[model samples]
Target: MIDRSDGQDEVAGIAVRIIKEGDRIADIVKNLLAFARDWKEEQGPALIQDILADSLGLVEKQILKDGIRFKTYISPDLPEIKARSQHIQQVFLNILSNARHALNQRFPGFHENKVLEIRSEVVEIEGRRYIRTTFYDRGVGIPGNIRDRICDPFFSSKPRGEGTGLGLSISHGITKDHSGRLWFDSVEGEYTKVMVDLPTVE
Candidate 1:
């Protein structure tokens, strides 16, 4: 009877493992489908602040794990913009994740004043109104020489087996598709700031 009981336990464990693997596969498929969705003409006016909150929520745990302090200065009454919510969320998540990774790489563990700052405002450039969002990280800044190539596909500063280097490239593409602009400024060994500018509905 003991042997039979042990066999049953083994089978149950295998079943449980299989279920977990299946769940993981399902999640991967869902993410892939979201990524492959066409963003060219999916223009819908969405609350930009709400999208930012949702994106930050998704990565809050990971941000906390590295002892990185996230600060936001979003404008309370920012106007709605035409954009795909999912794609905007993706853009923010990718930026936040990269900031966390960079902080970890520089400090390894928790350090005082390791901060990630996010800010948004309504700005005008050449007579056009835009909602400008900025993400700033006090971590390892990109080298000036290669800063221009940071958005190139498959370009990564991470070590082998760590990053595919496609995060920023995808982000750049998504921002462009929304008729927006994405760029960054960095002073090596100091800080890096990424900015996204999107047109607001009149």
Candidate 2:
């Protein structure tokens, strides 16, 4: 037979249920708050491909017509690392467009020495393969003082009204979320090399 004090157990059960409900409600509230703070734009992998294609199509005419020699060196065996293809495209388009802008600002004429080169290769570190992409341009390079802060949000070396400064910051965030790295090397009055590393699943 059950003890008469069994009411205590029933009350405890109800208290436990209340605690669980409270926890669930708290979790929901926290998730809603997070949603309000972040801009989630994770498109499908195919969409990223479309973004890449779109960037290539959009910039094909300008890069070649600018009279600045262009070159691309991609490793044939490098696999497409898991990434938002469109964001990747945006990153590249931004860099390429930036390259042109820097070159134009350097000289009025696109001489033989004025050129841009893009290269990609696979780098393996700690049993992980990464696609290392580099964008190099013989253009007026960024000043040392400002180059380090290029990825800082809302920090731009461009003239006022010319930049929002979010491009590189967004690109950096995307790379980081995909377990990658973004970096650059530049020397004023010489050249600049922007390197991006994306971890490959395989």
Candidate 3:
């Protein structure tokens, strides 16, 4: 009960909220429960165009601001995929930000120019087409031990308390819900590449 001295009774007004909340203390759940509920009910995957068109178009400014050179190799005629649009967007953004932060901003940097690449391809497996998308960064790579649990909740390389540590786990779940896969390969002093593959809509 935070004190409110302005003659306004917030506690009295919240009586209805408490009564409606029943046995659950919704106030205690800090994370984005609303978003999580929305995700849980997404059921099926999002349409490919809905996820890609807007996301790719929107990241240009952020990339330039971070001095990251972006390159794309998407097939012009690549087919659609199924996914949760917002979650998928989150996955991409998370990876992009991680790559940006990996850059040696103040120390001796990689002699090579900083670069990021995204490529999309459609390939057939068992007579069905699957869309394979990959994101690669020419920045510092992740260590193997941490990579093993990259999708584990509450596991993050970022400084303590700076990250919720749920982004990768959420992204992994979204990939699974779409009947797809997400993986990455990295070398500590080399580069990192993240791949996402989904069955193309038939």
Candidate 4:
């Protein structure tokens, strides 16, 4: 039999856990609502770092639970870009989700090489400046045979019913709409690197 004080402590612990879980669920719902809404007409100056942080908050727990290491190196002075904040965040989330899937596919369990890295910096192209964000993952990468079709609508390597195949396609459209460029580099069974370049505010 436990002492009354011990029982009270246990109950308090359980109550705290329940409250924490409830708060987490609320946050997930909030993010989902934000993502599902139409932000097509709300373009403004947006900070890449803030968008990345919000996107990562949505999936960081799941990534950690999958036994994969996640890392980020965002430049301290990333310039603001003109964008629909929600749409840009969706792009970040999509890339992160793809990277997580690749890492999980390659390493079913915990492994040293199961890692994802995100880095951001400013780059120049044809005398113009752009913010370039990259996502690198050590996972089962794209095969040369189908590499060109990764962004094609309804093209997915995932098994039937597991993926709708429009993630990258939609992401590409969003980037292009924001005057940005999206591309990928990969070697089968090794790694995949995804890069997105969005023009900065003049």
Candidate 5:
């Protein structure tokens, strides 16, 4: 038997992650095909739990590898929402990726305080019921001066080779298309919380 510290485990971990990523991409493709089939009709309702579970599965490895603590609170009784599940999953992926990047930027080495928390529940506003998923990250938060421009097209804090600055803009549009809302709040060095609200199905 080989010793665990010989980097064999690290190599295996990378292989596992690659396999998982491939599986996730295949799943995403299936969902996109389903969405295309129903393009002429209303996309339909998808359980918030299912969507979150899928999204989390895709990113959990990356989060763990980076030494970031990830936590979630998803209400068991939350109602399903009317929307394309794939699009919502994409939104979650994008933000999670951004959070991971921010945390890595702020704490290059293992940081005991790095945490990402996700909460999901049903909420009521003006007599309307909605499902909301809020993601909070203790990272180098968005600067106040550029907070308003964060979602604008072609705007990014990442270096040129790392990003195209279209993630948030596309996410914003997808949320709007589903009759939902995507917004965030942050303090430069404290934390950032992004909330996605989508109307629940009756």
Candidate 6:
């Protein structure tokens, strides 16, 4: 009877896991649909943390599958910003995608330092408050020669047919449209950090 009870408990654990996975997949589908729909030119107050959560939901599984450690440090009490949520989400998706690519290129296999870290905080720039979201990756950093052209249209270091070269360009434009700033800092063969600063709703 004891052995049978243990087997039943094991089955229950598996069932629970399956149910959780189903829920996650359903959430992913919902987020994807929201992401793919057309925007209606409506901008409103949005929580940056919520936008980041939705963006991560779209790519977190794949990043983990690639054996890169993902970490986040989001502060509580972050203020809302005036934004088109979908567009801001796109910018985050681009940054996360790039970070994943860079980590894969550098590691190609699991390593202790293969990591992606995202953090957020309220920052004051020019006496104005803004929420600064930063993505840092220990990956194949940007080369000096192409750093200046990284945001130029049709400029991609990726192999042929792999990239359209407009990800960063479009992200930059979107940030500007929202009165935000996007910039990058990197050291070749070491790491890359991308920061986006958007003003808080005053």
Q: What is the descending lDDT order?
A: 6, 4, 1, 5, 2, 3
Best lDDT goes to which candidate?
6
For model 4, residues 94-195, the per-residue Cα lDDT tens digits are 899889989999999999998899999999999999999999998999999999999997788987545667778879988998989999989999999999
Give the per-residue lDDT digits (tens) of candidate 5, residues 13-74.
98998997677567656865765575555568789889889998998997899899988898
As a TM-score, model 6 comes out at 0.81
Q: Local distance difference test, per candidate? A: 0.86, 0.75, 0.71, 0.89, 0.85, 0.91
The candidate, 1 or 2, that scores higher on lDDT is: 1
TM-score-wise, the better of 2 and 4 is 4
Residues 1-202 of candidate 1: C-alpha lDDT, one tens digit per residue: 2469888999999999899767756765676577886544467988889999999888898789778998899888899999988888888988888888777877787788588999999999889899999999978988898898999987888875456677889899989988899999889888889999999998
Model 3 collision count: 2
Q: After superposition, how far is residue 60 of candidate 4 from its true place, in Å?
A: 0.4
> Lowest lDDT 10-mer window, candidate 6?
31-40
Per-residue alpha-carbon lDDT of model 2 for 130-187, expressed as tens digits? Answer: 8888889878899988877899977878875466676688778867877888888999
What TM-score does structure 4 among the candidates reach?
0.81
Model 4 poorest 10 in a row by lDDT: 31-40
* Candidate 4 Cα misplacement greater than 4 A, ranges: 1-39
Each model's TM-score?
Answer: 0.81, 0.73, 0.74, 0.81, 0.79, 0.81
Better of 2 and 6 by TM-score: 6
Task: Determine which window of 10 residues in candidate 2 has minimal summed lDDT.
Answer: 43-52
